[model samples]
Target: MDISPTLIGFIGFGILLVFLAFRMTIGYGMLALGFVGFLIVAGWNDALGLLQNVPFHTMFDYDMAILPLFVVMGFFCYYSGISEDLYYTVHRWIGQIRGGMAMATVGACAGFAAVSGSGMATAATMATVALPEMRKYGYADSLATGCIAAGGTIGSLIPPSIAMIIYCVITEQSVGTMFIAGFIPGIM
Candidate 1:
């Protein structure tokens, strides 16, 4: 049987629309598209074989376990009050400049980025801790918000960063070195 261009276009359009409308997770969207495409091209039997086998491989895959481990680490760090201590330590030292509050915000962000992997988490934590104080201290909203907003990037750049750690593991390099390398880049 011939594969029609019209059918291909229709399927592609359908997938795009579904993704745009629901904003489904990328992995799920890709899996759904792949399953459907396989079914269309190779028929039910082959697609069934793949569908049956893919889940087992994906679920039981060795590398997949790392995600939960890192997530747990981040949650434990937050819940254990590590982020708070970090913020307080930085505030104690630098909480007094014209941009002292802003500097403190940056320091807190840098500190939080050390333990956390997610940039969003770093930003959220810094905002929660610094925003109110900055507001109360007569700091400009733009500088307060902007510093915290930009400081979030530190999470991704700092050593022990989740992204950096992943890269080290994937490349079979030293994690310590990678983390140190991230220190300056993240700070700047």
Candidate 2:
């Protein structure tokens, strides 16, 4: 009555796909199925210990705490109208230069990236705030979208990013040092 670990893994993966197809949240589905597979392959005690301890260590660690804080900051920036203010200020400053609107979009995205900490969110926010303005100025489709896509990626490279925070936690590196390290690359 023993199941191989490989077989359990395949079953878990299959269930994960089925859950995803049914529109379940990917993280939750994978977590539940992973635990189920662990219980079947290892034993009830090991599975229970994993369920009890992994989340505690992963989330309760002080270094990992910054991850949720940065995520919240991103939402705060989005909701506080700061993203729009930044776009307008940068736009007015550079609107007259050749390709200035696109540059301004990049600048605004960088500014927002500091607070948002999420690339996709940063891009979506910048696109919403900057795209129409660029369109009004007769900017081309590819150029505007390109600026947005590029700018969005800066969130991960900048400080207080969820990705960076996760990396620091997983590698047991200093969160502050990692944040500082990301700044130079993010700017270029």
Candidate 3:
């Protein structure tokens, strides 16, 4: 049996929608679609041959290694008490004034954003590390939690962001220029 590339493309899109609807992990969804598309385009035998080699090459890839390292670093910051110190330091320095604790939370989050790339991960980590202390201080729930959530989002916008850096590298542009360009937009 033979398949038209157009038909195969449509099938791939349908599968992609189904996977997304089912909430499969994005990376695994992409991998599955890519594999299916490869089989349709180049035949099952060739696709299998490539897959056998590709997984090994991809896993051992040095460039991609940074992704796991960053994830580990963020997780470590949460579990190893580093995040706790950061929040407390900010809290002690600025938690007295009206809205000062919230401000300090934002500041500390911006500082931590320098190290973490993923906004959601940063927010989750901050909540774990900061929420309890903020609550214990009689801080209002809405203010404390909202500030932490907003602060975490800064990780996605701040310079040295993985997305911004990767975009600049892929476009053959300077990372410094990309950082500068994003700074104004981020703060706006």
> TM-scores, in order shown?
0.72, 0.85, 0.72
Output the lDDT of residue 46, model 2: 100
Clashes of each: 0, 0, 0
Per-residue CA lDDT of candidate 3, range 33-93, in tens? 9988788679989999988998897677554455567667878777888877888888789
RMSD of candidates 1 onward, in order: 4.1, 2.6, 4.0
How well is each residue in 75-170 modelled by candidate 2, as lDDT tens digits?
Answer: 888789998999989989997888888989998998898887888889988888898988898988899999999999888888878888888777
Better candidate by TM-score, 2 or 3? 2
Span of 10 residues, lowest total lDDT, candidate 2? 63-72
User: Top TM-score: which candidate number?
Assistant: 2
Candidate 1 per-residue lDDT, tens place, 1-188, comes to: 77688988797778867886898887778788888888987999999999999789756755545546655766777788887777778878987756777888888887777666667777887777778888898888899889898888778887667787667757878777887777787767
Q: Rank the candidates by lDDT, best first.
A: 2, 3, 1
lDDT of each: 0.77, 0.86, 0.79
lDDT pick, better of 1 and 2: 2
* lDDT for 172 (candidate 3): 68
For model 1, what is the alpha-carbon lDDT of residue 177? 86
Better by lDDT, candidate 3 or 2 = 2
Best by lDDT: 2
Candidate 3 wrongly placed segments (more than 4 Å): 1-11, 19-29, 165-188
Off by over 4 Å in 2: 1-11
